[model samples]
Target: MSEKKNEGNSVSRRSFLRNGALAAAGFMIVPRHVLGRGFVAPSDRLRVAAVGVGGKGYGDITSFAEGRADIAFLCDVDKRRAAKAITTFPKAKFYTDYREMFEKERKNFDAVSVSTPDHQHAVAAMAAMQLGKHVYVQKPLTHDIYEARKLTEAAKKYKVVTQMGNQGASGDGVRQLMEWYNAGLIGDVHTVYVWTDRPVWPQGVAWPQTNATIPAELNWDLWLGTAPKKNFVDNLVPFNWRGWWDYGTGALGDMGCHLIEPPFRVLGLGYPSSVEASVGSVYVGEFNRGYFPESCPPSSHVTMKFPVKGGKEVTMHWMDGGIQPERPEELGPNEMMGDGGNGVIFVGTKGKMMCGTYGINPRLLPTSRNAEVNVPQTIARVPEGHYLQWVNAAIAGYNSKEAKSLSSPFDIAGPLTESILMGNLAIRSYDYREAKIDGKGYNYPGRYIKLLWDGPNMKITNFDPANQFVKRTYREGWSLGV
Candidate 1:
């Protein structure tokens, strides 16, 4: 495919400064004031280097480009997946290994956009921040709680603007939900129910016993990055990685950020005080329960309790794998509950409110109430949307008002991610087992227990074994570099 140019917008002079001969000449340039803020000379645009520039990554960079960002570099382990982006951004330099890209092109770009799998999010985003570049990372921020904490801290230490890829954080729906909650319309939300019909991919399945041939265009080792070394398997590349614990965080990790974020924002939630879970199991033979510790359960219902100020506690319920809470009575029998596939419900002392994923279509219960009530919009709306929010923030400099006001910066994203991953920890611990004394079968001790959490310490006070999931040891060679 031929590279297509944007209509009415020519490539900026900054592109020439960064990608043209001037950059090769090692010219040390001054700051962005030469053209002044009003004129927006091509040289003044934010230069971006995107890692994992394919799939969702490609979409991310495309948004940045559309936001007037200069896509200066593209890196992905699979050329097959990155083909479109390679053609689309022909002016951008390409690389297969991000480490090499960072080392060689660090000075060429002003910010980094990371859209890799959950496992690699922290490493790639951390590397960008370490180089003093603002970053936009996809959600659920990191694979583990520890990585989220580290990335959150790094953003402050590096003094770089940051935003997570959960675009809903910047949507008007959440702000509306927030305004209503603050107005006491819902009257002190005591509980929240967030559910999703996800795992649209397989889960609770055994790992492939046979290794398949790696794709010609892929660098298998590089794609494996921080994950444990494993033989290439069929269909694992572009998507199915979600089923396995090694690559994805199952349905909860996949949808929790979108579903849970609304409640977090509305309630000003932080780490949970305790977590408990119940998971649906897959059966093998007539009498045998299939136990694939390497995979997430086929379905699960997790409950987490958060303690707010004034000694009030709120309970949040997370349901996945097609599970959903009972329809709110206020909803008409014919009415849809949260766009049908995913939704969130906040139950308060006075009434209930709900929204679909990304907090879209938020409505107060008894549907009629939506028409009668009007809450002032106290929060600012992100008309530019999530992608541009990050780009604009980056262009505004680290300490600028825009940077400080990002909808999902690390300070918020990190803890939100950690809180969501906590449910995964409970789920994983639920599957935890030990050998029976008689050696007949394993004894599942982690099941049916509410694991007490020490959020500040990031530990399961009641279950020592579950703590292992809090911070996983990386495969050799890859490190968060904390």
Candidate 2:
């Protein structure tokens, strides 16, 4: 697409409403309360298809199917998963390949819920939107930074009601946190410590020891999708793929959207000025193979510096693999730190607000005041469920003020995804050099430098090679287009 064309298709409030109205006219309209209550009236039932019906995918489908949406199609590379999902929607058609599902059943679905791995999110969502189907895509919006940008562009071009799968975006807790921040409870935030105990679920301490045979039930080629082909290993299939560099974005990408989204939303954080990483590795022999490639540091500690629209700087630190910053002494003996996996602790000039992935019921505190700070009531509350919001939006079109208000379009989702991926890039760069923090006198090995960014140019002025990782070549026939 030309620069002009791409810019024109970028997300905007006006475009969102226009597309929403167009989509609403085609689908059956139901009462707003019906959708809000998680029930779909018979006439307003959305004909839906779920791509990547595994782990999270199954949960997303069940949420919709149990509600008012009709599951017309279930697609997965694994027959076991496909079969299991099929039982729930016995009448829904099933497919091993999603492209085939779209081609044959295009007319049947009013919307699609994409629950695929990171690499496949863009392709499946793009295809669905192109067909004029509404989309609810799980977060860390896209596999790579470019894809997130493109998907956001496509959502606008197609005039579809689109939502990122950061379900917490709809939560009342998250909204309250944002309101608190906006109300100056935290007072001029400058730094944040967000850590997760993730990858523990799927991230291996080390890479798989041996390549196990691929199961016959799984279509290994289709599973690889746009990533380079590799021999199928039993450990790499099903759920463990999150540790690998190709299929997943490791711990950061997996949980960044959920954990970092609140700060991003309330702060209106734009692009980062620079990023650096520190981490542990497991390279044992001549060939370097850690849990992730030595080239892609296994347990990463990344710091990103963002120069907001104004002159102020916002620095964020992210660590995975059960690592966490020292807890503030102010937290009372009864105030236990939440689970390590995917949480953010905002450090402001005055106080702090801490939250976990999905930003569920975040807590606020004063540095010295031990007791929890009383926060006032706010107007916005997180929506009931992320998936349900998208469904309602798809049916009513952008015209439903309720749906538009609850949704997080690509504009918001795209930058958040970009910020998350910065950590990944910093991890990769750490393998090459030493880095220095802005104010800290400490210098460390394998530290990535903070390169200035030009978002529109998609370039890092000081880092030439780093810019290349932002975009990747897609396998033929599977590549996305404007």
The candidate that wins on TM-score is 1
- Model 2 over residues 89-129: C-alpha lDDT tens digits? 79988888887777666656788889888888887887778
Give the Å shift of residue 104 in candidate 1.
0.5
Error of 1 at 287 (Å): 2.2
Winning model by lDDT: 1
In model 1, the Cα lDDT at residue 56 comes to 91
Write down the worst ten-residue block by lDDT for model 1.
Answer: 1-10
Deviation of model 2 at 102, angstroms: 0.9
How does each model score on lDDT? 0.85, 0.72
Per-residue error (Å), model 1, residue 461: 0.7
Question: Model 1, residue 124: what's the lDDT?
Answer: 85
TM-score of 2: 0.84
